[model samples]
Every structure is written in C-alpha cells, then in structure tokens.
Target chain A: MIINGKLVVSSSPHIRSVESVQSVMTDVLIALFPAALMAVLLFGYRALITMIIAVLTAMLVEAVWLRKRDIFNDGSAAVTGLLLALILPAAVPWWVVVVGSASAIIIGKQVFGGIGYNIFNPALVGRVILVVSWGGHMAGDIWSTPHPFAFGFDVSTVTGATVLASPEKAVTFSLPEMFIGTIAGSMGETSALALLIGGIWLVYKGHIDYRIPGGFMATVFVLGVVFGGGFYGNHLMTGLFHLVAGGVMIAAIFMATDFVTTPVTPGGRLIFGIGCGLITMLIRLWGTLPEGVTFAILLMNALTPIIDNFTIPRQFGGVNNSA
Target chain B: MKAGNVYLQDLSRGIINENPVFRLLLGMCPVLGVTAFFINGLGMGIAATAVLIASNVVISALKNYIPSQVRIPCFIVVIATFVTIIEMVLQAFQPDLYEALGVFVPLIVVNCVILGRAEAFASKKPLLRSLVDGIAVGIGFTLALGILALVREVFGQGTILGPDPDSAIQLFGAGFEPMGLFGQPAGAFIALGLLLGVVNIIFKKFNIK
Candidate 1:
C-alpha cells in the first residue's frame, strides 16, 4: 500500500484497538475505587490522608520529572500512587508516603524512560524499596487494627499484627470475618470480598485478562492444599484460607495482570501467573518473610520478556520443520 | 605556555573527564564493596591512590626495558609490589583502618584503575606525565567514592564519618528513621547510578567532555 506517494509497510497487529493509555488507566482507577473506599471505611480518615499524600506526591514528582504541566491528566501516575498507598499500612508516617511515592515516580517509572518502558510495576517497586528501607514500619507488628464503620476512631490507639505475622491468633477469626474487612493487614488487602468486586469489574470492563488471575489463583489453591496444614479442620478449608490471606487476592488479581509488566502472549500470561504463584508460596512456606506477593510479582515481571519470547506463536503458514 | 597547559590538562582530565569509577567504570569491585560508609570509602580511596602513584611511576620508568609481549605481567608485578608495601604500612600503623578495609587492602593489586593506568597511560607517556596522570586519576577515584559514601551513609544510617558507631556524627534527630537499605550493597549500586547520572548531566551542561 502507498500513502502520500510513499510505500507504507508495517508489521502485523495492523488492526489496532480504540483504547488509549488514558482510557485504560482511567478504567484501572475506577476498578480500584471499591478497595480504596473499603480501606478508608475500615481504617478511618488516616487511610484517606495516606492515599491523598501518595497520589499527590506521585503526580507532583512525575510532573517535575517530565516537565509537563498536566501530569495528573494522564492518570497513570495517580493509579500507581493509589495502588502503592493501598498496599501500605495505614499507620505509616507521612514522610514515608512522600518518599515512597516520589521513588515510585522517579526511580521506578521515570528512570526506566517512563510509562510503558518500565520493566516492573512502579507501585511494587516503591513498596519493595519501602520494605527494604523500613521493614519495621512496612511489615511485622505495625498493622493498625481496623475499627470498621467508625470513621471518627483514632488510628494510633489500636495496633495489631497481621494474620501472617500471628497465625496462632488469626486461627480464632472465622472465614467470614476474614472475607469481610475485619482483619489486620495492609489497608486494601484485608477484604477479599471488596477486592474480588473490584477485580471482577476490571475483568468485565476488559481492562484485565482472567487467564492470568485464574492461573495464579489455581496454583495458589493447589499449593496451599499441599503445603498449608489443616488449621481449619480440612485441607480444602486451609487452602481457601490461604487464598483469602495476606496480599494474594490483591496481587494475583490486580498486580499480576498489569499490561506493561505482564506477558503479552496468552500462553505467556498463564506461565507468568503460575510463576508468580509458585514463588509466592515458596516465600510464604519457606522464606524468612511472612508475605511474598510483592517480590513474587516483581520477579515475574522481570521474567515477562523471556516468557513473551518463548510463548510467541509461529506466523501464519510458517515453516514447522523443527516440530 | 602550551607545555604548562598540557600538564594541567593531564591532571584535570582524570578528575572529571575520564573518571575511572563514573566514566571508565573500572575497579568496580572495591568501589562497590567498600563504599557502604564514608570512612571505608576514604580508606579504600587513599590506599588505592598510594598504590596507583607508585605503580605508574615505576612502570613509566621501566617501560622501555620490559618486553612488549610480557608487559602485562611486568605491570602486575610492579603494582603488586606497591600494594604489598601499602598493606604492610597500613597494618603496622593504622590497624583500625586496616581491620575496617579487611581483604580489600590486599585486593588493590587487581584494581582495574591501577593496572588500567599502567597499561593505558604510563606505558605510553613519559615518567613525569604518567606521574601527573596517576595522581589525577587517584583524586578522581577518591572523589567518586567519597560522594557515593556520603549519600549512602547519610540516607542509610543518618550519620557521617561512620568509622565506628561511637564516634559517628548523627545528622538526624531521634524521631528520624534512616533508610536501612542505603547502607546495604544494593544501596551502593543505587547511589552510584544516581550520582553517575547527575554527574553526566552536569558534564553535559558545562560541556566538560
């Protein structure tokens, strides 16, 4: 074909989707609202403060780095900032929020040549740095106990360990309570029901592929049954508990399905999800840390390119003599 | 007039234009290994500088006599001799610094900056010019290590000149929490990468190259 008296030749993927970066990012923000609302409702006003600080700091840093006036218009930076805030403890100091948000924008995204060029999920990168830098605040017994429906409650009064941190105490809490937003953990990770609602919405909107989350949860369920002891009487119940525990729901559903950091091929997405599940279980079962979702997804993000390479389908009518 | 300017240029080039750590990226083992704290970086830099100067002067004086095919071995022998001398001197007098530096003091023999200068500069240049190059390169390496250590120590530990925990000067107050990762090996790479980027930007702004 010729255009403007010049030959126009391009690779496959000639039929492009109508979705823009802004539209996709906006859909992600919409999908995240339920979890964000649950976080504020569960943790009180401090959670809102943390989220605001994170999102604003991220946008400001991106704007400064890119020298663009309308940084928040793109919505990607806000999504990253909000996702990072969701995974952090509600009791985290204001400075930690500022530093973590700035690092997510500057070191994680901008340093890698910005947006689609980044290798890892920018939010996870910031969380990892925060975990490494301030393990005391990011993990361990720093989780604030949620006083659900009490928006006026002070966050400083009540503090408790996460379920993963104190499994002996956690065993007393019923499955329904865990599924609701009554557990002590990261702001958004406590409620499996809310996260599932958001995740399903994203899936319905075609913002995320189900195969990756499906493969991820399946691997986790199988491994949980194999590794997780029968704490709730039966192995199946224990596996379900593992599925609802920690950051598995949020990470598998939201983080692993990231468009840029995840594999492009359908087969590659399955492999990527399985890899994330295997690493997460390994860390939870044998590693020193209680939670493994962040590292697991980041490690899988690093392998995305290799997975894409192996899973690339042969061209139409291409030679298959090697097979 | 031109001769004096050339000599000055030789001294300044290594300090910025051809910085071994940031520019040439040589001797990364010691640079990354010992730059966790300010004092360790200073100790490593000074030790490497002493060895680099002695090796460069000796190699430049003996370059004509050494066979071209066996020049590398000759350079190693010369550099190793100076490193051993510096090692003994540090152990006898500065025992604390020697202990802090550990195996890195002896490992200076294989540092690319010393051997790199011997092969690339001293082997080709005259003795006086080679001596200037060695000193200039040594300063550059010291400056690079110092800058990295400063950033790492301040952010990682919230202190400066942290040779010993007792004598370290605390920059932050009691409420301040230091970023512990900055004090680890990973922090060294992050600090070095950011510093290298900033240095490159500054070099471009001023047309240093």
Candidate 2:
C-alpha cells in the first residue's frame, strides 16, 4: 500500500498500531460527544452553530491547502478542525472561526511540514491567534447570549445565567447543575462530568497516554485545593468548579494530550503536565484573563521542544555530561 | 563580493536587501514584543539602533585587543555598557517610552542582531565600515518595526498611535483609523506573514534571486 507519497517496505513485526488516523479522529469526535452534548444542552443552538462553523471552516481550509499542495487522503487537518471547533465559544463569529481554522491548517500544521512535524498543538495556536486578534471579544469572558436547549424541562432561566462572565451568577448555579453540566460556557468546556466520562473512555481505548492529563489535572487540583483552603466543603466544591468550568477539563484531556506536540517519555509528559498546570493556575489566579487553560496549553506547547530535549531517554552506554 | 564592496553590501544589505527582522529573521523578540503601536515601535527601534551602533563601534575598536576565546564575553560587556546607558537615559528622560519598551530596551544586550553583527562583521572589518554596517542594519531593523507598527496601528485600533497628541509626538504625523485586528499579537504575525510575502515577491521581481 502507498502511504503519504512515500513508497516503502518494512520487515516483519510490522507491528501496526490499532489506532489508524481515521480511527483516532473518529474516536476523538466520539469522545467529544459528551462535552458537545452538554454544551448544547446548556448553551443551546448557538454552541452548535459555533462548532459547525469552526469545523467546516477548518475542513474547507484543509481541503483547499491539500489541493494547493497536491496532497490527498490525510485526515489530520479534518481532525484538527473538528477539535478546534469543539473548543471554541459558541458565540464566536464565523469569520473568527474561519481565520482560526485557516491559521491552524496553514501555519500550525502545513507550514511546519504537516501533521507529526508540527511543533505546537494546532488547536491551541488557532485559539491563541483568535484570542489575540479579537481580544475584547474573544478573550473577554462575555457571552453574546445563551440558548439553552431543554427537552420540555425548565432551562430558559437555568441557562440564561452567564457562568463564565459573572462569577456571582456562576456561584448561584447549584453543585448538581454544574456537576451534571447545566452551565453556559464554551461549546465543549462547560461540563466537567461529561469530559471526565469521555476522558475515561479515551483511557480505556488506549488512544492517549494518560500521564500528561493525569499529572496536569493533579497539579491543578492540588494547587487549587491548597490555595482554595484545602479541599473540603466549599473548598472542594470551588476546586471542582475550577476543574469543570471553562477549558481546564477539555484542554487537560484533549489539547494537552496531543501526542505529537507533547513529550514522549513518561517523565517528560509529567513535567509538561506539571508546567501546564502551574501556568494555568497562575493565569487563573493572577492574569487578566479568566479562562487561562487555552493560554496555559499554548504556552506549554511552545515549551515542548525544550521539555523534550531535557527529557530524552539516555542511549545505552552513553555517558551523560554536565560540566 | 569584493573588499571594497563589503561595506556598501553590509549597509544596503541590512537596510533592505538582507534586513534583520525581514530577511535574516533575527531579533524577533523586540520586533514582536514592542511593536504594539507606532511610538512603541519607534522607541524600541531607536533604542536598538543606538545600542547596535555603540556596540558595533566599541567592539570594532577593541576587536584586535580582545582574545578570541573571550571575544563573546568582551562583546557582551561592551553591548551591556551601551544598553545600560540607553536604559538610564530613557528612564530619566522618557519614562513612558521606557515603560513601553519595558524589558526589551535592556534586552538589546542579548538581541542576536547586535551581537551577531558585532561578531560577524565589526570584529573583522574596519571601524568605518562597521559603523556604516551598524547604521544600515539599525535602519533595516527600524524599517521592519515601522512596517509592523504601520500595519498594527491601522488595523488593531480605529486610530493611529494612541491619541492625537501621542500620535503627533511619536509617529511623525502619520495617522489613520485602526482596523482592530492589526494591534494585537495576531496582527503582528499577519503583518510579518504579509511582509514576508511582499519581500519575497519584490526579491523575485527585482531578479535579486
């Protein structure tokens, strides 16, 4: 079989991994279902609109670029586009999503020699570009409006409260409401519970290395609990709020878990996760932005090379030197 | 290509032919970090130019006296000295520009363009050629900043520079309504990308290939 323009032959043990690109992408989309469902449930048709626009724009850009470069059959761009769309706030304009999708596909993926060669997470790059370009609109924790979809249940008032922009309003969201994913936020970032469910599925499928996400969440929780007065009662609930709210869960489980951009070794992934956690917490605590998980993931993505360099496994019989 | 042509080459090359930020892609930290608006760009560009020129001249003067092994260290000291002076002067006279430039002004000590020019050209060339090269490269750096600011100012905000008085004082009377996308960090990249594309087209058209 011809593979990606290169004709090659390999010896037996040709141990093929079960996770094909298509399978992986499909699995990721499946994994996102829970979060996407929660987002639609809480935020309504607007979230759906945002996700569709983001995904379509990304895919169209990818297809155009592929045509321009005379390459076909690579599905990574589609995966990236879908992933980026799922992460964005539903209220973001189609133009913003288009710009992001184009940037991610052209600059983050294709410009850096495509797919495995990309140094940073394409979704984070797209998100950051969007944030920086439209700071007041994108970064500011403002919601255009929430369109909560309830199947005959009373969600008109339940979802009207802007959980991200107004902390006072968010505070009023009952623990059960927040836990069961009844808050308005980014299309795939509101429901901590749904994300956790998907994360467990991903872990079960062995599609992702668990070290990074586990370490990242651990760091966020530990630091959050410590600063939040030691994880009991209000503190526990608040810490959980930080965990479930915004992009922390989505990023920890999805974006930060990107295989190519993240470190390979267990220790490297651990360090990467810890760094992401620290930066995310710091930004949440001190930075002007409210949802810092995007920035944190982007910042850590930029530092992956340095992390990889330090965390590279020692060659057998090679002497490590530090003078 | 010849000894006589080297000086002319270095000067013109830095200005446009082989611009640091545009062509060589050196000293990006300041170019991106400082070019939020027009005046910020001008201040950073000028500060960088001053340090570049001073460091090049001093390094050229002491090139022969310094040992080959310790040349980098000696160059740092010279560059650092000039940077310190610039920082102090900016702090005393132009606190706003100083704050605007922030750590980037002091960061000139490590700007690869300054040190790179010093080590690559000035250390070997005569003082006059080195000075010319420094000025040219500095001009080139300033030009890149100018382009970045121009794009950023026009797009990011509805007005050029900050306010009317600020623009008049900082941006040499060039003003325009901002476009919103040009002032942010993403604007920086878009500007750089477009500039790079333009540079390539110009280079190809001029048969400078």
Candidate 3:
C-alpha cells in the first residue's frame, strides 16, 4: 500500500481533507436555523407546531425504516427528517406530515438503497408526494396570524401567503422585504437573509462546494432576467424571493448539494446546478404549479449519474483535450 | 391440427401468460400515461390491438420478401403505416376518443409488444398463425389495458362506467361518488404496480412457470 516510496497505510493521496459527515450535517442544520426562525415570526405558533411535528415524524420514519433494514452508521435519517420539516408549509396537517415522512423514507430513501444512496433529495420527494396526494389540503387558504408578545409592530394577522400563491395578483414586495426575509412563504423560505447567512456559514465551514450554489443561483438570476425582462430590481427581487421562498434556499444550500446525489466533478456540478435553476425558473414563470424547485431538483437528481459519466475528469497525462 | 394448435396458443398467450402490461411489462408509457379513465384504457388498448394484429399479419405474409438486413426498417414502416391509419380513422369518426387517446395513438408504432411479437413469432409463423398470434397479443394488450383502466377509474376517479367528470350517473341505478385520486397520475402508478403484483401472485399460485 505504498506509493512512490512513500509508505502508505491508508489509501491514495494519503492527504486527509479536514471535513466529516457529522460536522457537515451540523453546518446544514445550523444554516437552516435563521430561515426557521423567520418562519416562526411570520407564521406564529402554528408554524412552530408544524415544524416540530414534521421533524419528529420524519425522524421516526427514518429511524424505523433504517432499523427495519438493519443498517446503522451515518445520521442521514435525521438530516432527511430535518430537511422535510423545513420544506413543509406551516399549515400541513399532522397526518400529511406523517405520510409525507413515510413516503420520503420508504420510497425516496429506502427504495433506492438508503440514506446517501438515494438519487433525489428525500424531503422534496416527500413534499411532492403529499402535495400530489393532498393537493386540496396543502394548497388551501391557511395563513399564520400574529401571536401575543409582539412589539409596537402588531404584525398579527398578516394575511400572508407565498409570493407564487397567486401569480395573477400584482406583487408589491420591496427589495428590502425580500432581502430581510420577512416574506410570507414556506417554513424555511420566509427569510432570504437567513438562508444567505446559513449558506455563507456552510461555505465557510466547507460543508459544501461553493460552486454549486453560486452556479445555481446565477443561472436562476440569468434566466429570470431573460424571461422576466430586464426590470432588474423586480426580477432580481423575485428571483431571490423564489430562491428564498419555497425549498430553493434550503434545497440549494443543503439538498441539491448532497455529496452522494450530486455530481463529483466541478464541471458536472455546474451543469447540474444550471439545469436545476433553469427548470425552476421555467416552471415558475409558465407552468401550472407555482413552485417547481422540488421537481427540478428531483429531475436533475435522476440525471446526476449520467452527468457524472459524461464529465469524468481525465486521467493525468491521458487523452489530449484538443483532440 | 399442429398449425391450429399454435394459432390457439398465440391467441391465448397475449391474453394471459404474455399480457403486454401485467406479464411482459411492455407499453408502460401508455399504460401509466393514458389510463386516467376506463374509456381511455379501452380506446387505447383497442387501437393498439388493431395496429398490432394488422402489422403482425402483414409482416408474417411479407417475411420472405423482406431482406434480413433491412427487416427492422421494413417492419417499422409497416407498423407506422397502420398506426397512422388508426390515428386518422379515430380522428375522423371518434373525435372525442381521438382527443382522449392524444399522442398515444401514433406512439403504438414504438410499442414493444407489436415489434416483439413480429420479431419473435410472426416472422417465423405461417400467415394464418401470424394473424392468430397478432390477434392474441393485441387482445392480451387490450385485456391488460382494460384491467388497468378499470382499477384506475374505479379507485382514482371513483366512477366505474360513467360519463365524463363534468357529467355523472348513478351506481347500480343509484348515485356514485368518484375517488378522484385514481384519476390522477400517482393513482395510475399505484394501481399499475398493484396490478402487476396481483398478476404475479396469480401466476405463481397457478404454477404458470
């Protein structure tokens, strides 16, 4: 197990990179905290209840499935549970939460081997399944009214909903509102600021390669400009809103960057991220459904293996690139 | 007697042992895509069966005349011609069913069941036997589609044999409530999966190995 007279006991390169699965998972959870808090502020007590319920349900589902399969090593189940909870709307019913978690764990994760082996993000799969099965309930008119202990703001009964909830209605949200992350949306999408904060932390900690989020958001912004016209501020704000609003921020920072599911090479990752961004923008602009990030991520997830195959890094001193 | 036996075998094979959807797992794109309604399933199955049977007979009769090197292209041309004819006929006479069948009508040319039967059975068989084989396979495809449609219609949309969703009728001469989920794509997948499972079990129990 030696290389070039360098006595090697472990493996190739023998230069260990300073990153572990637990730390990376922790960073992801930490990154999501700000968005979670903003969701609490906007949606009030109900959001908290749903978040707790979703997280616990997801965890239980993952644990039970993992135990049944008799494989225990990584804490991926907890991540799935956490991600699922974050992506869910505050108004999602307890039963739906349970069912969604089960679907994510059983079909999304377990069916395709398990944990890191899943092709698509488990949380997106769960959310989409619930959305399809219980469309009426999930998409119904339910908003978080304000609670007591409010400052002079009296922000109660914001009559709030996601930006994409009604595309026909004229949206007048300012850049500051979107930037500060006070927008009305999913549990993890209330605050763009919070997501940015978390994303920065992930990058600093080296939990994820920065190129993915950078590439993905850039593609989204470019596509938004191209399709939505050069109303730069409005388009930028909306694109950022879309990024922050539903699962985009959470997905981009955490889910889409899944080590096992995403492409290994830098070029492949760029292509994958751009594809996700473009698809999401298209669906948002024209498709029947408002949010397409989850579907886009899943579709790209299915293509990751193929993308890797085509973008494999050349062997050192191998085939000429010009040729 | 031997030739007759083979024809009978081919006829029965598609209906049961080699059911295009449940047994052989062929033509899944349409099975899952178009089985939103029972009528849709029936229409699609019948249309596909027609193309399958006609193409099989034509290919069988012309087997000798076709060059081995160019047989696939020739078979595809034959199949595509029948599919186009079916598409046009449906469009002209049954516009509603035509609308419901949609792009699937033309897609029958690519359906593996028709091509598979031609390559495996028809080319080697006599004209009479090939016709029987085609009919059998077509009916089998139809039966599978029918079963899928029945389950999907009953469970997803909650109507067994009724008018369109906008229109309604009674169940057993009374009123009926549809399970609208069955009308959706997810329900189609679950129903198809369950049907595949049930067919597998029945085959196992009957020792159809």
Candidate 4:
C-alpha cells in the first residue's frame, strides 16, 4: 500500500513518539530505583542479593518464554522482579526469591499472554504465591530489623515482627522513623519516603495518573481514622500510621497504578483505587491477613475491564448516555 | 458399524472424543474439589463410575417406559438410587474414604457426566451400547481424575494415597518443599488450566476439534 505516493509498512493512527516500550520501561526502572536503593540500605546485602536474583530470574524467564535472545526485552520483567523483591521479606531464602520471580514471569505474566494482556500485577502475583506457599518465611515475624549502612552482615539474624504484625508494639516506633524508612517491615515497603519520591517522579513524568494514588491513599486514611480503634495512638495518628505502614505505601504508589492491570478511564481509576483501599482496610482490620494490598489490587484488577466499560465518556451532544 | 467395531468405538469414543471430564468438562465441582489427594480422587472416580454404569444400564432399559416430557426427573431418580447404594456401601466398609470424600460422594447423583450420558447416550441407545458407553466414559473420568490427582498430590502434598506416613508413598525427600498452591483451591485451577492448554495443543496438532 502507498500513503501519499510513499510505501507504508504499518497502518494509520501511528503517531510516532520518543516513548518506545524500552524508554517507558527504562523510565519505570528509574522511578523504582530510589525504593530499590532504600531496600538495600535498610536490609543490607541480603536485599541486594534478593533483588539481583529476582530481576535476573524474571528477565531470564521472559526471554525463555518468548524464545528471544534479548533478555532485556522492554525491561518490564526487570521492573516486575524488582517490585516483587520489594514486597518480600529480607529473610526469605535465595531459592524462594528465584521461585517467586520465575513464577511471576510465568504464571503472572506469560500465562495471561504477557505484558498488557495480564489482569493482575505480576509482582503482586509472585508475592501472594510466596505468601501462601511459605507463610512462615514470607510473612509471620520475618520482617528483619533494618541495619542502615551495615550492608555486609546477614540481615535475617536480627529478625522482628513488623508494626502491622503487632499493633501493641506500634507505639514504640515513631511516625518519623516509619516515614524515614528505618522500620521492621518488608525490604522496600518500610521506606515511605523512598516510595513517595519514586511515586512523585513517576507522576511528574506523566507516566502515572495522580487520581488513582490520590483516591487510594485518601480512602485508606479515612477508613483508618474511622475503624483503626486507636490501639497505637489517637485516631488521626492511627490513620497516618495505616497510610505509612506495611505494603500500603508501596502498593498505592506502584502496584495499584500499573498501567495494564488498572482502569484507563479517569473515573474508573478513582473507583478502582478507592475499592482497593476499602478491601485493604477491611482485611487489615477484620480479615485474617495483616495486610490485604495484594488481594485488594488483584481483585480490582479483575474488575478493570468492567470499570472501563462503565466509565466510557459521554459524547458531547449525546442526549442518551450510552455508558 | 461392524459388530466388533461398534463395541470398540462405543467404548473408546467416551474415553477421548466425549471424555466426561476433559472433553465434555462435565462434573467440574468434584474434579476441582476432591482431587487434592490421589487416593481421594481415584476413590471419587471409582464411586462416580459405579453409579454412572448402573444408571446408564437402568436408563437405557427404562427409556421406553419413561415419558420424554419428564425424562430428566426419571434420570435423577435412577441416578440418585445408585448414588445412595454407593454412598451406603462406602460408609459401611471404607469409612475412612467415606469421610475423606465427604459431601462429594452424594454429589455424584447430580454429576453432569452421569446425567449427561443418561440423557444423550443411554436414552437413545440399546442396552449393550449404553452399558459400553458408560464403561468408556467412566474410565475416561477416572483416568482424568487420576492424572489431575497425581499432578496435584505429588507437587502439592509430596505423597501418594492419603499423605499418611505409614501407607502413603512419599515421592520426594524431606528437603522437598511442595508448592502449597497445589494443596489449595487456586492450585487446582492453575493445574487444570495448564493441563487444558497442553490438551488443546495436542488436539490442534491432531486436528481433533
């Protein structure tokens, strides 16, 4: 076919931009870097080892699945691996990390036809699998005490329960400490500051929609204040604590905002985010699990298509609202 | 059909072409619910098969007498009668298995495979053909359960039979950590999905669809 007397290899509506998948993925990696760096700083060399294994395994699995020589194809696998590692405890065995990352690439992504076709975030899928398969290693009291700058020692030797794991101990840890990232929790999730910085970067670059995170955080804060029982402190303080604790910060910023699994429409995204928060708080307060971000986001992810369908924008002059 | 060919085809078709579990995807609840252990799944398969065969023979013989307008109710009554017999026998003899299978044994009455065979094959066919069809379909369902159970139990529980230390055979050493997912309901879905994918690829290759 010829377009304006010139042969064209592709179809129309091809608005070429500088943002190839490689560039977008590279940008995402950059956004995730501060959190990943903070994980290593907080958990030491163990976190670093876990991160490397996860990233490598994810990339390798993707490459093998696609039968491609390029292991760094688009770099989404790398992002998934790093994200998976962030939510996992520093004390998990090397094999668990390997298995988690491999399963993330296979069952989470590839099984759903890869990349954009998947409904749930691959990293969260891996985390849930690890959580269910090895609850003792993944959850329980495995949250390692952060040894900032002590990157050489074994982090697992000084294991303690996370603040979310024990509300009674929540009074001991200050909000500022949790804010600054030195807390007993999963590798990257402890550092609310680091995650916020990454999140701000992603938002500034126009990669993520602000409404989703805004809605998610707002809902969590509101629910925490209402139902959080003031066990650790005042209602407002408990709300603040819920916002910064466990996987809430990390999931609100990274996992829930995933472009593929999340709703595309603005209104739909807000609904999705709020739904995620509702489920998260419901589980945290009443459900058996200490944190419910993974299942919350996954459930919302399953509803994404429906959300998008319902939120289709009404036409300018249309009296009848088709949506 | 030739005399020998008719018998063989009627028997073999249900094993592959009209396999109750794999081909027809009938009776999914038990397939997903009870296949956590090999012994439980095999036991379920055997129990369901017994009821299926009995109902098929009965339904084929009674097809002429039963009115078409109320065929479904008649089928249920026949199927339920066999299920009760099987359920009582299991309870009296294999008490452990009866407990292991739990609600699933009685559920065999509503199992779509048995009812489906009765409605589609047994009601229209002669006694001998319906009986042969029942046997074939029963084998297929059992075989499917066995395969699914084998996969789930070996990887999920790391044992065969009942996960019993004395009786059950452990496939892996102590260091082996079974995927706990296989032990849960979600694992059943994933296992079934992956198996279905492989089966689909085979079907495509053989032009079976």
RMSD to the true structure for each prediction, in A, is 3.2, 6.6, 6.5, 2.4
- The order by descending lDDT is 4, 1, 2, 3
Model 1 chain A: worst 10 consecutive residues (lDDT sum): A1-10
The residue pairs that clash in candidate 1, if any, are none
Residue-wise lDDT of candidate 1 within B1-209, one digit each (tens)? 99888779998898988999989999988888888788989989999999999999999999999999999999999989999999999999989888888999999999989999999999999999999999999999999888898898899989898858787999998878999878778778877889989989998999987
Quote the positional error of residue A126 for candidate 4 in Å: 1.3
Better of 3 and 4 by lDDT: 4
Question: What are the candidates' interface root-mean-square deviations?
Answer: 0.8, 4.1, 4.0, 0.9
Q: What would you estimate as the lDDT of candidate 1?
A: 0.89
Q: Once superposed on the true structure, which residue ranges of model 1 sit more than 4 Å away at CA? A: A1-18, A316-319
Q: Please give, as one word, the docking class of candidate 1.
A: medium
Per-residue lDDT tens digits of candidate 4, residues A212-268?
889999999999999999775799999999999898999999999989999988899
Pick the TM-score winner: 4
Model 3 per-residue lDDT tens digits across residues A254-303: 77887878899988999988888888888877888777888888899999
The best candidate by DockQ is 1
Error of 1 at A94 (Å): 1.0
DockQ per model, Cα: 0.79, 0.25, 0.14, 0.69
Task: For candidate 4, give the docking quality class from DockQ.
Answer: medium
**Considering only chain A, what is the TM-score of each predicted structure?**
0.93, 0.84, 0.83, 0.95
Q: Write the per-residue lDDT of candidate 1 for residues A1-323, one digit (tens) a residue.
A: 55578666899888988788898889899888989999999999999999999999999899988899997868899999999999999999989999999988888889999988999999999998899899888888898889998897778677789888766787887889889868899998988999999899999988888888998888888898988877766789878887898899999888999898999998999999999999998998889898899999999999999999988877789897644
Top candidate when judged by lDDT against the true structure: 4
Model 3 CA deviation exceeding 4 Å by range:
A1-34, A37-41, A56-73, A130-159, A164-181, A218-247, A282-292, A310-323, B1-12, B23-25, B50-95, B103-112, B126-135, B162-209
Error (Å) of candidate 4 at residue B13 is: 1.3
